[model samples]
Target: MRLRRHSLPEPRIQSKHTGMLQRFYNDVVLALGHGCGSSHLAGWRRCPPALTIICALTLGLSCKVHAQAAGNDADNANNTPAAPTCLPDGSGSLKARLSGAVQAELVWGNEGTECTGAVRPDGGIRVRFSHKDGVDGGRLVLLFGIAALREGQSAKALPVNVTVIREGLGEFYSTQGDNKCTLDEVRQEPLVGIPHRSRSYRIIARGFCTHPARAVRGNGVILLPRFDYVGRIDFDAEDKDETLEGGAMTAQGRMKQQ
Candidate 1:
């Protein structure tokens, strides 16, 4: 028998869905800039951009559905207002099953026992992690202190290190070991960078602790890693140098720990 010939499928045409996605980001940036709080995120689900992306991904696989899923990306770009660089303070976002919201407030680390009443670094940065809950759900707080930070440390600045020293692994899951976890494989990017007019630094840190339990999906155990928090973080080190609570400071970063 002779083999049949097949032609490749054409690309999908454009649609309004593309603009919907842009609007989503616009709203998100706007919400973050205004300090909308975690409550504003609930609207993301009802946001049309999600459905537009889903349609583009799953249904668009087939050439027949491609055109239907196509969206006009330019439509929204032309209509939306100019979005300024959003530098959040004490509030951020989390990427989870539902894209949870996080509130990472930056405070003096002197209160925690782990610090041992040791003085914060002069021109150095140190932070500690604690589980936090928002109106919608849970997030993390970065109790931190920065001292003697020179203006030049902005670029090539040292990694602002923080360790999760909590022993409450059992609180979220059945097993333990996630306690005393450190941020590993962290990726950082400066948004409103320091050493500049902007006050915050955009950074991403990964390697959140794995859940203490596993799931059995079939004959083999299904690997279910828990508490892997990742998102953006905005850190500001202008004040509170060499002293805890001596001056005011704030933190809101989105990090990814994979």
Candidate 2:
């Protein structure tokens, strides 16, 4: 028996889909910038850039289908915008099953509890994890306080986590943690911040007793620095003087991974 040489089949090129595919690619590009909520995506005239990106990605991928009818169905679904459904707060908790829409998937420990309280321009937010009193074994809970910002401005300005103590309480504040988060850009004309003008925020993660809790018993404070944001953090003493700025007035910085 003799072995025969065989040529491999050439890759299929779909000429009819060329024009359609190019348009699809453009949509993907637009969606990428928006999905990440980059500063460049925020502009006048349009739906949220992030949402636009989701639609583009869905359509682009669906167009890969060899069957024209199937591809068209996918494309139509991507192009159709679902009715608006709002979350209590515009956190990443919103979910829509449409082919194209803004969405997020959170894994445990990765997505901490989003605290209900927030810090003011002059103040901050306090988060508490409840525990049973006198319990030798206890579980620690983690929470996240996301900062809200202008459509594009949200991506700018590094977020810093500072620990501010008042008498006996610790408070945490985020750059975008407040009612300011819910403000509508289309309805509200806001001031643009000057570059390099940064605000320091404080976030307090404290553990307290919930079972018959009274008189601040069995309470402890765990200060995790640099809760969120991507940038450099400085953990240093506010003052060199050993007299005034001891552990009480002393400040320290910790790095938070993005």
Candidate 3:
């Protein structure tokens, strides 16, 4: 008479857990059959009690370890912080309505935009705005010739030199040899979270052009009836001292006094 081989019934559960459990069952059944010289369920009934207990313990331990590893992976993913973005707080912007040669409502914001300002050696402040990695983009520059500016202070009707450059197109100046645009009002405020020693101030300004900016080498003109922007300026020790002194001296006067 030939002995018929018997296979273990598969677990009712259908998932990765079930697959793992099935593998463990197969291993145990193989070991029991080897010890009893029969690859069938009858061999399991004939195996020693200690051997069956050992197989059961091993399967439980493996499943527990796998579950712990999966839990650790999930916890690590949850604890990771998100990446930081550029200019997340919308601290910088430039908005304006243009007419004449360049006619468009220009709105540049913190995204992909860079604005920088510094104190000129002559006590002037120059602010520039441009696009990041923009080889063929537009650029705006504002020049303020004030001797000193302070936080929470406002200046009005100040003469400002404006320059707009459109790469591959042309360059326009408020006045080639004169002032055609005036800052209607500009207010300065201390930027929070910055160290006092850094001497950086946020400036918000609105201005308009009495005449259009004529192209340097062309007959083109870009008219801006109104424009506004938020920018920053870094000042030095000398500039700070000038602001503290409450002196209404012109840039040239300060130079002469020095």
Candidate 4:
């Protein structure tokens, strides 16, 4: 704003030091032009000498401040080191096997839940399961928020957002690995919960690792209806008029009988 109103300041170019400083400023401005909207450095480098001096002076102060800020960050990190966590053996794969009666259920964004909401995936807690190998396995995850199951609608078609995930089992599943993965079958099926009898679905899908690592991968189908539906969803809905319309999503799953 100030620059727009007043004439640019003249650089009192005197000594070789001043010339060197001006060149340095020009280089810095050219390099940083992209951040301010210029796609190429040539345009910014062609700026007037006065503008270059002004930007150079401003950049000089900024560099000093940035260096100080970085130093402070390093000091803070050194002073407040992270708490040591338990290191597991081998790799960070989920150790627990899912099957039969031994089950796991999560209902976040509910009345009593703290995290797993419509917008953000904050407030996640560690959920542990007894591994078949006797190792207590766990994953830190914030499940996507759940909405009321529309009758005759598959859960796959529901709109939900996930925010954050901790570095652990959940991260492994969510983050893509270097090796490609393929699904054998993916469709929505019955999501029958023994206690919570509502519209639910189990994703009937089989995953295959294109390049097997350590001669291992997920076994059987996604167990325990953790998927709760087997279907495909393509969302084209856009938000307009304070609502989402014109977007379409298709789901295929059985709604639990009322």
Best by TM-score: 3
lDDT of each: 0.31, 0.28, 0.61, 0.30
Decide which is better by lDDT, 1 or 2: 1
lDDT of 3 by residue, 1-258 (tens): 324455435567576666666676667655556678565556656767746686677777677868888998999989975532223367788888878866777777766566666664555665666552244554443333443444345898877765565644434334432267778889876665554645667788988878876555446777878888887766652333232112212332454576
**Rank by lDDT (best first):** 3, 1, 4, 2
Q: After superposition, how far is residue 213 of candidate 4 from its true place, in Å?
A: 8.0
Candidate 4 local lDDT, residue 101: 22
Candidate 4 lDDT tens digits, 192-251 = 433135333332333433331110122212222232212211112211311110010100
Residue by residue across 99-211, what tens digits does model 2's lDDT show? Answer: 11111121212123222222323222222222111223332222222233222133323222222222212322222222212211111111223323432222212121112
Error of 1 at 73 (Å): 46
Query: For candidate 1, lDDT tens digit of each residue in 76-195?
Result: 557875432212343322232111121233332212212111124344444333433334344333332223233223322222222221122211111112232334434334446443
Task: Please give the distance, in angstroms, between residue 26's alpha carbon in candidate 1 and its true position after superposition.
Answer: 58
Clashes of 1: 23
Structural similarity to truth (TM-score) of each candidate = 0.24, 0.18, 0.50, 0.20
The regions of model 1 sitting more than 4 angstroms off are 1-91, 95-180, 193-199, 209-258
Q: Which stretches of candidate 2 lie over 4 Å from their true place?
A: 1-114, 121-155, 162-258
**Residue 119's C-alpha lDDT in candidate 3?**
63
Q: In terms of lDDT, which candidate is stronger, 1 or 4?
A: 1
